[model samples]
Target: MLGAVFVGINAWLPLDPLKFCISHTDCKLVILDAERAEKLEPIVDELYAEQKVIGMLVVNAQEGKGQWRRMEIFDKALQNSAAGSPPLEEESVLAEDEALIMFTSGTTGLPKGVLSTQRQFLTNVLNTQVGPRRAILRRGEDLTPPPAGPQKGALIAVPLFHVTGLTSYSMLATMAGMKIVMMRKWIPAEAVKLIRSENVTLAGGVPAMVSDLLDSSLVGHPLEGLFFGGSPASELLASQAQVAFPTARLSQAYGLTETNSVAVGIAGEDYMMRPGSTGLACPVNDMVIVADDGRVASHGEIGEIYLRGPNVMKGYYRDPDATSQVMTTDGWLKTGDVGTMDEEGFLFVKDRIKDIIIRGGENIPSLLVENALYEDARVREAAAVGVPDRRLGELVAAVVSLKAQYGGKVTESSLIESVRKSLPPFAVPVMILIQEKPFELTPSGKIIKSQLRKLAREHWELRQKNIPKSARANL
Candidate 1:
């Protein structure tokens, strides 16, 4: 195996975050498309001067687009450099060597780079690859190989930079000899067509995307395996999916970037039986629900979830303090979600204690949005919370109490327009509620997000009250 660590950067990142990561990771070479290169044109010289990125290989470049210094066309570079080069001497690849780095948002506004070792990466692949296959076999499906004609396909509607997209979809599909079909963007009608045309065997997306796909008239039973993640799927949606795709094995997985992709999963009939639960822990992993008093919770008791496994991350890249904060002295990672482990070991994710809003499976840090709002002089205090929506699992929305002097002068639309310039389109607040009162606070004077979340969800529900119940169900 090559001994190079690959940093997965979101292709949709704006210039500020893109530059921050390029410099933070001490990246040397970057491979991007011509359009992305054009986006970096203004800071090309600055990046080079700071030695953040010394070289670039432009993928999908036009004939005259490789004019940037130290930049080469991807195809030409591959052809000229590796045409006749001799194979290098083999080196031993250690299991503990760093393999992949992915950025994840936490309580802090900025993203932290979560590092995974080779062993951890491979373990995650095995965890995902084996779970569904065994589920299929346990259900009495024939294991005999079909005659070699067309390869089975995995339809990927998510971004490749994500842990689920890269590890679960791309790597697992490649290892299983399945054809990978990636969509540039998610369009339910197009996704349905691709499933039919490509002989897709496995396909899935977040609950919100799946909701949209199920509502679309174009959807039909396609894949043998159907999985959902990003956020918990409601009982109604899971029931809807099972009814629509009777032939497919419906699955739901639970984990974060720190766990590679999945730590617990449920599929098939078991998934439907307990649609509210995220399922049993992986056989090779250790999971326990720790109570508020620092002891293991009894069956059906809610507590903080803790996970330990070969697939767990090594640490946050170059940030031991942050890593230590999340990990116990015994090595178990403290997943801030409160959940209960039933007698059967199925995990019910009752609540997420973290202030991270997952919109369509993408983690949006509330602190990040709050920081952007604070930049405007009119914003006295702003709390960004997840607003429930039928289409997106949660949409980023803010409640702002302006400074006394600027209270009546500021408008919600103006504040949203100001943040759009800095944050990515998806990260921008979709709804900004102008409030006159301060947010509810805890005994320690910290903003009570649980209270704010309730308010946000209620606001969303109230706004949709006028729509017909049948129409609102799929909105």
Candidate 2:
């Protein structure tokens, strides 16, 4: 509904129900499903008392009683309005007018509401269309005509709250007049079923989703393409996906919430050729890697990535200080991700600045170590973090989930040796913990490394206590 309203004069803010109350307190009205309405009943009463919320509009309620009886029924409100009056004249809205306030996924700390304009959202829609053309050019192949008969359908598995799902996929699909099949929740097997049943030609989300789809029983499904962004995907996963889905073009995109989703992307042969790269900048955006001193870094030199484009968000909502810190007066938004760009313009995201592990005074890119661990055929998922050490200041520790087929065959020492082959000795993990289940993933399908770091520390401490006092000294 917010997506539809964006086409008109009314500005809409999409809130994550879990984070909404804590992150925002100025909501004037809340339109929610019955389940959420019940959950927010007490909180809404407090807000109503405080005069923050004017009323609640509940939808999909079979029977209204108690608290719900006082609230307006959303369906009835629409029906009554339609019956009583003629449509009002549309209000004029400028392209510069604010359209949405999307909050960041506060993985690190408090979530900041990102303000975006009508122009920015539409600009992203236009830019996203260029992806297919870029893929064609990069592959040096003519566009493949759709198979005769039905319209091409796209399967949407990611939550609509995300920029990728809303603007990038859903909105883009709406503009294209394509058939959209939305999943209530992301279940890999269910997604595969939808793809086959709905004749879904395009499917994408995070790497984990793609990986699970490829590893599932329906690997031979007729998907035309698969693309993912949001987070870094291991090169090993890319290689496996390409082999598994020969008929589908595998692509990876690189962007952020502030950039409205994709600033760079690679597809087809280009993606397979460059293993860990996030690909070239999108035609609509300009990207530069800046050194700490503020000069543009030479190609292949790691630096902070800065992007400037129409698609960038207007600013942080009502937080000028935070906005000023990230966005330069000149219009460039400083992406806190550390990366390098090749001479050919391909960008390689190294790691998030906060995610880099410092061991014995040497900065180790956690992503590099994690990628090495993924190279092992038995490894299903991997995460690396720095744990405090009495002697080395910090030590590299890794937690990995293994393929069920190789359950007891792969050992901790073997996994450590695999990473040691590709990385320096210091960069090698001092401890490797195997997880029986997959690592807990964020809604966006990224591993919560902070939680893994805490788990790793606890496991290490427990192990030290079990060892003899003399042996603990060597450990």
Candidate 3:
């Protein structure tokens, strides 16, 4: 019911329509903190377009113990919304329409509003086979369900705006009539505490979030299920999580906003066998191939990923040209992922054609390099990109994060040594940058290579500026 804490500080633009839609629905009350009101008022003004009385239930989120501040903020926001605005008049808008409008992370520029319909939202939630479905099956055998009632509830820590957090994982939990808990903001330590205190049954996050939880003490707590999507989690991390949370089902999937949520996921036993695979196609979804010459790729051959399902979006809002670019006249949505299916129908993603790098006649898949470096205990995260190289046209470069045990030291020599020990020399990154922190990630936890490329270019330019003119001439 339009309940948020310090809304103004969380000024990410995409949440307005979603919040508005929720407030207009069964959730009418608006609750926010008084200290946050000054900031949130502008947001409420932007989101609440109707000319009606909206009430407030304000509390001191900064003061008081526990979640008192948040509780108060929620109380006040709901009260204000209900008391202030009368229910919005019915327009031509469909009753089953426009449930939420979230913006993309704006990788290229400003975020664009992605409107989701109620039917769309409901379909994503129900189709998403979340939590521990059919009990925790281990060793190809079914185990007993965890104690039912409140203990079986789920946790939602990721921000509500993201698709994984809102559309699939968390939304599925909410639709199941389970109690949802979240921190006023994401604090890994706080999330751990919630898991223990709330007896959380399932936790959903991206790879980065999963990595952070693994790095945190939270993994020690009792967890029944751990599912992540939006970005690929390394096989190393997935294995480690399974070992740590023996009782918890650990799995990952592949999907995009245009697909509504997850169109494919690895479940139970299959999750372990297909380490790098994106798992089998989800129920009611059809995944097929369209080759380079408009012919279907044979089984076991790589081709563009295409899909037909109810989960497929109703095309981008107000952008017909953009819609036609991805969707065929026959209704199959061409996902840009390059992949192949084995005889058994498990999909293995080779690489995105757009993301492949050609360097000195060598083809480098950034995902491969990133996966290798992630296997190292000292490496928290890594990303590979192509940079200008005079002799080779473009050279592969890597940015990496080191674990605390490594004393914050990331050296090119060490990484080079590691890669050389495992991969061929051509695939090894020539330039390794040890970042003090993890590379900046998208909301979905993907390493923003474009941002990394920009930073790398700047760093190279700065280094060049420091070199003496005579040194450049001599070189």
Candidate 4:
């Protein structure tokens, strides 16, 4: 309401992230509910002293004031300000003014603060509009219209702190005066209920949430526009969702915090035609696939995707050196994503540049391995990660969650054999960790591959530790 530049962070995050968020962004004031306030009590001194925080506004003073003695209660402050205050004077806010500090890349638990301006986010919204409906696909393509009602709502099952929930959904929805129904967490059953009850027409989330929603689907769906971000929607997931809810115009986007959420987008038939493509760039943005040799890539060649546009963020907040590493002098932001571009301009995302596993000088894309795993009937969710190997430097390893019915019965060896049939021997996961539960996901619904990699290493270390010294040498 005050139009103050704020940092949006996960309330469920540990104290280190909380401290980093405050200190890195130089956040002065904090607003928290009862639960978070209590957790923050331990770090109140650090926030106030080293971080130079003025104070905090607690939503539930009764519960929050136990150990965390904040200066003013939220409601009390609201009441006092309203009682005898003069007419509100709006500050001069420009499109260039800093609007938000969003953190990304916490796979290993250290997130970079991406700075964004209001105009940058607005362009991101526009990029979504242009990318999906560009002349390359078809101008004025008649996609499914949103359902009509007194209150047209969108369900945000992801946390508000995430870029998807904030800029991609809430900001756009709010600007259009659309009713926004929020969820504390992704509970597909409760989400189904909310969509039916609220008459939600614009409802979308991550692919995993969509899969869960299908499992818990009730009779009718009011959804007309279903959008996905954080990761690309798999062909199987997209096809299943289309079959389930034929009325909804399915859209998928690929972006990062540095891009303010949208670098490219695809929708309807355009998305379906390209099995795994993240889609084409908006006209306003210049997107190029730069090959390993530093030349602009030809069609169908795999390279690092580079983007430059109004939607691109100003820079990583207060980290000039870090910002310089990603942003080029001529202006293109070197996206660490490795992908191929077709003649039609659609981008096929393969894997991150850093995540490409090199075993004895042979480069293998993790996506190729993961895609092979997905081809198996038993696999539900799969992540192929590189695990440390003394001889090979890194070896292919996979952590997978089986489809509910296949759980406990499916052996790791069977899945490895399945992958081996599709991929080269070097690309096959040497070790597969089969689990019943889904991979622990980021707020944006991306699988935390780093966690699975760590899991594989720990398992290997434990097995080595358990083996007798003589037996280890003999083996």
**Local distance difference test, each candidate:** 0.82, 0.73, 0.62, 0.75
Candidates in order: C-alpha RMSD to true structure:
3.8, 12.4, 13.1, 12.1
Model 4 stretches astray by more than 4 angstroms: 1-3, 60-67, 106-109, 131-149, 355-475
- How accurate locally is residue 263 in candidate 2, as Cα lDDT from 0 to 100? 78
| Model 1 agreement with the true structure over 43-130: per-residue lDDT tens digits | 8888889867878889888744656655788899888778877766676779998898898887887778889999988887777855
lDDT, model 2: 0.73
lDDT of 4 by residue, 1-475 (tens): 5678978876755566567887888888888888888778777877787747897888877764444565567888889889989868787888998888888752232567889898987886667665445533464546554566588888877667777778887876776567899998667788888988887887777666776766775424757777766656667778877777787878888887788888788887887777587888877778999999999999999999999988898898888887898999988998888899998889898877656665533445677678789999888888777776533446788788878898678877788888776776667887787878766789999987777777877766665578422111100
Alpha-carbon shift of residue 24 in model 4 (angstroms): 1.4
TM-score of each: 0.93, 0.71, 0.60, 0.73
lDDT string, candidate 2, 240-314, tens digits: 887877888878777777887777878777888897988888887999999888899999899999999998998
lDDT agreement of model 3 with the native:
0.62
RMSD to native, candidate 2: 12.4
lDDT of 4 at 227: 77
Candidate 4, overall lDDT? 0.75
Weakest 10 consecutive residues, lDDT, candidate 3? 2-11
lDDT at position 198, candidate 3: 77
Residue 410 Cα positional deviation in candidate 4, in Å, after optimal superposition:
26
